[model samples]
Target: MTKSYVVRYVGGPLDGRVDTLPDLPDEPRSTVTHVHLHEGPKIVHHYDLCYAVEYGCEYRLRADADAE
Candidate 1:
């Protein structure tokens, strides 16, 4: 199976520095294995996009779909 996702810093200046969206992890488990993607989400984004998947968290991503 395939999935979409993104990765971002835990909490820093680059925090929420989304760009790598729609990442298909080799296996989506409690811990991610790899993240070999860095592109915008597959949607009409407006502002910025990012995701967080660390420190006891799931693959939560953010995008600006409001923009066209």
Candidate 2:
């Protein structure tokens, strides 16, 4: 099975967004991650484009799960 990575929004304007991706690059540029949020107990997946900073930003990059 293939592993996937996801970005969990902890703060900022893109809060409450959990996006999944197959792989994330280590370049200094902007990448889009699908933002998923729930409203009124309804699961809403917002394919919102979010800018990720490699140097300075409130967002961060980390492993979605343990790789085996």
Q: Worst lDDT window (10 residues) for model 2?
A: 54-63
Tens digit of per-residue lDDT, candidate 2, span 1-68: 87665555644446665767686646523433434565655432223234456312324333344544
lDDT of 1 at 45: 22
Give all candidates' CA lDDT scores: 0.39, 0.46
Q: Per-candidate TM vs. native?
A: 0.25, 0.35
Clashing pairs in 2: none
Model 1: clashing residue pairs?
18-49
* Ten-residue stretch with the least lDDT total in model 1: 43-52
Error of 1 at 11 (Å): 1.5
Top-TM-score candidate index: 2
